[model samples]
Target: MEFTFLFSQFMSGLTYGLMLFLVASGLSLIFGVMNILNFAHATLWLIGAYICFTFWSLMEAHQFALWVSIPLAALATAATGWVCEVVLIKRIYKRELHEQLLITYAMALIFGDLIKIVWGPTDRLIVRPSIIQKPLFLFGAPIDSYFIFVILIGVAVAVGLWWFLKYTKYGHIVKAAVYSREMVGALGIPIPKIYTWVFTLGIFIAGLAGGVQSAIGSVTLGMDMNIIIQAFCVVVIGGFGSLMGTLVGSLIVGEVFSFAILYWPDGAMVLIFVITAMILIVKPWGLFGTPLRA
Candidate 1:
């Protein structure tokens, strides 16, 4: 590919990577602290998009829709997570990994179909804000303002997470609990409540990610499936429980798929899996994960 072509591809890759990070961060967080594989995570994103579309359609202005849908979507996703935790995931924490995976996968299928029942099988689009519809020049290339927003939001989330983990008291508590759950519980910390909050927060992030994505393109019923597989690849490549790993893995996968499609349209999906398989063989715990702990 020519330099210009490669540059544009790289920019596209960055946008894709940021979107993946938005989804993967929530997955990583829940898995990191709770030790559960949440299959319904991507469905939450789809739910958020649908919720955004519903609100946007009801209220015609892009600004009004954007303002209302984000928090509403987040709240809806959080409530769903809380209910799922109470009704299902919490009970299966001590079960086999395969069992938890099976249950969550079932939940994903159920939730996805439920969304279809509510929103129908058609795709729905969000009206992008006027400001985001304009392109910004970067390095002699025009970039979508919406993509810039994704990158900025992702970076801000990363920084905020880092700061929360490093400086906040509750964050330290969570870290302690992650390392020594028994000891943290013994010290009078409400581990159950903490798990609930963490789980809810993760689901909310997934919802926010989806709501944001609605602005870029149409939200289809099957978008969850498309995103979940890539999110899973990111989780695997980054390791199940590592935040930084998720971020890096997302970028790698995003770039690989973007460039692969540019050169070999049919092989794009396979390339990342091939790379991930090779990496797992070399370093099973992922690039940033702690092998023994995870």
Candidate 2:
């Protein structure tokens, strides 16, 4: 019985960690490729959740409402990301670091307000489709069926990204651009265009994660605040631009938080920070990250 209980907790932690990976992977990708820290990424994710809710609400009578809404929300969010990149982010590419940070931070505030105005103060909930409405038992442990789906999505995204980076021409360009944007530009690649697409792609993943999250529970205002901080921690721990590191870091955080909550509910968050601090002290650039060039 005790083993079963522990297994359940482990599964819960794994689910939470994969969710973090979904959010942080895009974040890491954007920062790795563009050197831009997007303060509004989580806001964009929330926007995706809201968009999915809207779409699902519109077709609530149908069985396929949610399945269709997720991708639509992702595309819509990607479009918004593209607009931000073209109109605002593009202008800041060569600006001072503080200037870039200020603009993204401002964007976060603006987007947050927009979410309130559009969605109102009401919390949105997505009713699970009949298929995932019940729990599944694994070795005497009951697990939410939806959680399995989330895990699959996380794994798929990870493998898809790996294949893209390892096998595709554009992926190679993206990787090269990460190390030497100027050199890639000199070789005739359109650096600005790459930046635009990469930013859009990152937000698209965030949006997809959001859509998935909407089905997990109520979508409320200010939800992004909590997740954004954690997402940043995931990126920092995993090392920016390292997909494998992001996966491992997310699991570490998720499991640590899950188990810690059982033993020390009040200190769960503090413990996470303590671990982060230790990692930073030992390796300033992170476990998988290379040192920045002078």
Best by lDDT: 2
By TM-score, the best candidate is 2
Q: Tell me the number of clashing residue pairs for each predicted model.
A: 0, 0
Per residue, candidate 2 scores C-alpha lDDT tens digits across 122-213 of 99999988999998999998888888988888888889988998899999999998899999999999999999999999999999999989
Candidate 1 lDDT score at position 19: 87
TM-score each candidate: 0.94, 0.98
Worst 10 residues of 2 by lDDT: 285-294
Task: Kindly report which residue stretches of model 1 are placed more than 4 angstroms away from their true locations once superposed.
Answer: none
Worst 10 residues of 1 by lDDT: 59-68
Which pairs clash (backbone N, Cα, C closer than 3 Å) in model 2? none
